[model samples]
Target: MTTVTKNKVTDLFLENAPSFGSFLSLREESKQIVNEKGLPAAKDEEYKFTSVSKKLEQVITDFSTAKPIAVSKDTIKDHLWAGFEGSYLVFNNGIFSKELSAFENSGFGVQMLSESNAIALGSIAKAEKDPFIALNTIYFEDGIQISIPRGKKVDSPILFLFFNQANEGQIISPRILIEVAENAEATFLEHSISLDEAVYFSNSVTEIKVGQNSHVHYSRLQNDGSKAIVVSNFETDIHRDATFTSTVVSLSGDLVRNNLSLRLQDSGCVGNMYGLYLLNGKTHVDNHTNVDHTKPHAESNELYKGILTDQSRGVFNGKIFVRQDAQKTNAFQQNNNILLSEDAIVNTKPQLEIWADDVKCSHGCTTGQLDEEALFYLQARGIDKMQAKGLLLYAFAGEVLEHINDESFRNYIDGLVQERLGSNF
Candidate 1:
């Protein structure tokens, strides 16, 4: 087994190693991390419920020999929003697709990295700490560098679309880094979708820096093909008086894992995290979030909800840390799950670690089925059984959706939620 796995890693390395000369040192560092940690095992506390290493190994074996699928401009034209007035940064199978991107009418500063520049300053610490992130840094072909000038708020939201077309099973790694200057504001919307019949792997990493007094809002949609396996990370650094918020909606995927982390480096920072996962058909999703309050008077809030049916499974783990000197820190976290089927499973854990004496912190976790009485009330209102259930579930899922400020995007997601609830009826 050891020999087979070693050869598999070698095969991938030979095929995907970066040709960008300046990244040699950084690649070596990331490779060392991958070699030391490999993939997280079931026994690893952080990955106890999701033992994905074995599954990832199997997919990678196929990735080593798979053929590149065809990607045409027309194939993805329908995926973009009509009359979109903002710029777009697109990636197909983890590589930049110039033919499909729109950079002509961009309002904010947008630049593509020169191999040397992206590697020298990209988020390398996360790669050194996590194997999935390490794999991305070593093999990523190209990445985008987005700069929002000080005091300038973008007129429209920027869209970062990652569309995968894997005719044969393969591995796709997408890397992105964004910097918002002091007093600047911007909104980024990301959509990851698979339009192929093959089972692929998507290992994506995004690093965002919110400068002092800046504001950043991000919304991510993970609706990959049913057989796709995904491991992604969204890490942000919050500077003094900066605010950051993110909303993640996971509607589909076979084995999905997401890590959302925020670090409050200076005083008066505020961070918000919200997510909702609707699962069915043996799907599995795991979300792990961490917020570090390192300075005084910082605040962080997180709420994640899940709805599981059939034999689907979901996991949520949230952690908030307040340093000793982070006096007046305010942190709150909550996780709620509803198992719509008897065979469904959900594991939720909320944690708080505070070293400061004068701070307010709270955490809560809950898992339950639909409210029987409420369902009955809806049924008594002349609604059929399936319709009543859909109504209740729709309301349950709307809490997180309501936070979206984009009308068109929110309505688009609302239609998906409605379709999801009306399934199997």
Candidate 2:
């Protein structure tokens, strides 16, 4: 047998990263964190259920080189939504593609990170807490910064398309920073997809700042190829009277981990989070969320659901923090899962840490199979077993899907969910 050299993933990435750039100081700081903490292992409490680093090492042999793949306009059109009239930004293999992107109006300001001076780039989603975030800060080639002017309401949603087509095993990191001014309203959609079957790892970070009296709606769809390994971090800060809502849908991937953090900085801020993960084959998906209530009168709600089949596995850990001064805070979190196969498994934990006595905070989780009585009742109505199962599962997922505000995008996601379930609801 030939001798194979093994190296740490952090070392491999550091060796391939550039030593000079405008973000040199920030990158160096992140580099030191990565070198010191490295990727989370099984011993890490936060990542005990998922081994994303080991999965990366098994599929990725060369992290330094990326094979050139041409993506034509027609290729992009194939993936576009049928009736989407909103603005769109495209990223090809972690690099922003201006030629392929389209802006329908000047309602919002967009700038490339390399060309703009973004003071809030590393503010919300600090890299020191997570190794994946640190790696993204170190490896990201280009990113986008979006700003919504004060008092402006964007009529159409903004869609971010992250497409990856790599022949060799490489790492792809995409970064996004969005700032919404006071009294502004905007919606954003993030979709990540892979066109090839190559083994590649994706580490992405997104930070959003919601200004006072503003409302922001954000959604993310992760539908990558079977050989893809993905780790994503999303952090947002909500100011006084601002409202933030986010929905994350994980459909397919070999291994996927999502970390979401929301901070309510002032009174009257509201944060809402919803997530759905449908897994089959040997896929593993982990979702971790944190909602912090710092000021009084703030509110937060979180709900995440998962359906696992075959030998797939799912993990959900959600936490709510009510600080000492966060009186009159109303925070709730829940995670529910349904396992369809005997070999499938799910681990769910919902926690609440309250330092204030006046706060109304509660968290709970449940994991079990589909209700046999409900299935039987559906079968008794002359519905086939498969169709009954599909309808039941669809109903289970509908609660989360209904939160999606855009009708067109909601229908699109509904169709994808039906297709994955192999039946219409």
Candidate 3:
């Protein structure tokens, strides 16, 4: 008989779990879940392609104490987007930094999670199902709740900047809850960065609720350093006549895994997702998305693209489910990849499970190198090989970048993408 021993990292998480919170019972329950399930191993179906737990074990030796290093305002200023006139909420090492954060009177309500009586904090994200989410629920130090009042349209965007400066190996979990009331609209940007080349594991969770007749646009940028490992879960519930759109741009990281789940709870709801991951070196990025349509007259669209060079790897698994009651549903999903090196690899799977016969659902995936004829045509011109390759790759990534709605944010992300592609044009 063989007896399995629990990983020390899990024990560290259990030992350092927060004891006080309004959601103490929920946190306790999550702690129990984590204790029983532990972290997902390579044998797990959902995480087979990416071994997140093993990778964490390699880099993180201790999680009992978080050593927070001071980051200057000049350092923060260097990362802020130029011409972005919105509110800035800074999180230093996964804890909300009130002194470093600045707010604009955008008419939205902002409250600390530890002090607010938010009933929907744990309603959208289910920790019982995912161990990473369970870890986040157990170890999150502090978070924020943003509420948009009913019938209000916010003009400026809200940027949540997370700067990690842990000297020793540590575990950082950042939690966020957003609520958009009926007939309201808002945009949010979540950006993650590492101030120094520190070894750390960041597990983050964000839950959003879109009320009836409301619209929400969310964008996430992950540009952590090469020594950082990150796992993030983004879950949202869309109500009747609501629209929700999310764009995730992953540029660099040691090991990054993104789980995005969208649930359409009522009729006439729409959900759209777009993702772009450009990787080099030995970095690994895995994106898993699930879109659930539970009612009639709902729609969903998803498109994810990847460009990998050197020895980097990419994985994408997207699933769409239409229940029996979800008649007249429309869902489409596609994942495309371009491998720029002989050693680069990508694994893509697009799935659709529809129980309703009246629904229109389809999914497809493609993985290949750049078009040789097009490259030859460009080389036939005055463009060199590297420049021509960069141009082609940039054009390949533009399909996903075009879906971003905000002009300023889109332009900033465009510049980042261009830099990654090494294309000056």
Candidate 4:
């Protein structure tokens, strides 16, 4: 038996090696917020469904710097985004790759931020106690800092490329910061992909702050290799009258978990979250989201759908919190899952903690197979059994995909869904 050490990096940092003095301040700050002794286990309320302790038992080599590699444009040709003609930031193996990236401007300036720029953005994410975040803060070599000037409406969408190519036992961390100034409107897409067959681990963090009356659309697509392991956290703060919408799709990974938290700090703000996951062949995927309505008249809506097949496992835990002073808050949450095989399993929980008297909050979750009646009805209309099943499965997921405002992006995802469903669809 092997003993698992928790927060090994933090422990090493605190022990006075101080070789990386540049990150000393950050390490100290993180130690103040996070529990440094015990690793988060399955018993922790927030990590009930996801546990990396077993995998962490293995010794992991700390990756602090990356060796620059030359990558041809043709290598990334198959990954070019569709209908996106705005700013682009590309990262390979957690290191920013300049040659493989493309950027377009329609008048307003869009550029990657230097180290000086990262200093200011780092100040905004100082309130959290996350180990993954701590590691990323100190070691992330380069991060894309996107600043949309006030009142500017970007006609096109910005694309962020997080491409990884590593073999067994390798670890990668990519960091990003996005700031939308007051009344500015923009969209961002974060895509993660891997081409190699490796049991690698990827730890990523993205911090976003939406200014007053700003509108931001953020999408995260995790389509890594089946042998990959990923853990990511996204933290966002919304201001008065601002709108923030996010959709997460998880399609591949040996063990994957996403932690999403939104702070509705100001009144008259709206937050929407949507997620979809398709798992098969012993994969394990979990999504845990928290929406906090801390001010009056704030609103939040969330819907997540999952399709699990073979012997795969899926988990969804969604929570909505309405503070006492958050009067007139309207929040709703729902989680639905479809299990295609008897060996497949899904664990879903929708939690609502409301402390406001005049708030409207509700949450519900259901896990089951496709409706037999609906499948039979479709098959009666000349559709074969497999086709009918595929049609019903696509329809089940279409509800969430419909929320995407970009027609081109939505179409691409539609095609991906069909591909995942195979000839049946």
Which residue runs does candidate 2 get wrong by more than 4 Å?
1-7, 65-68, 423-425
Error of 2 at 313 (Å): 0.6
Residue pairs that clash (backbone atoms under 3 angstroms), model 1:
none
Q: Which residue pairs in candidate 4 collide?
A: none
What is the Å distance of residue 270 in model 2 from its true position?
A: 0.7
Score every model by TM-score: 0.93, 0.96, 0.96, 0.91
Cα lDDT of model 1 by residue, 147-244, tens digit: 78888888688888887866456668777788888999888888887876468878888888899999888988889988898999778888999999
Range of the 10 consecutive residues with the lowest summed lDDT in candidate 3? 1-10
On residues 1-425, what C-alpha lDDT tens digit does candidate 3 reach at each position? Answer: 23232566666667666666567888888877888877888888999999988887788877743545686788779888777778788988888877888775777988889889878877899998689998888888778998999999998888899999676678888899999999999989888988888888899999999999999999888999988899999999999999999999998889999999999999999999999999899889999999999999999999999988899999999999999999999999999998878998998989888899998888999999899999999999989988898889989999888877777778889999988788422
Q: Clashes per prediction? A: 0, 0, 0, 0
Where does candidate 1 stray beyond 4 Å? 1-20, 63-69, 81-85
TM-score of 1: 0.93
For candidate 4, the clash count comes to 0
Q: Which residue pairs show backbone clashes in model 2?
A: none
lDDT values of the candidates? Answer: 0.80, 0.88, 0.88, 0.76
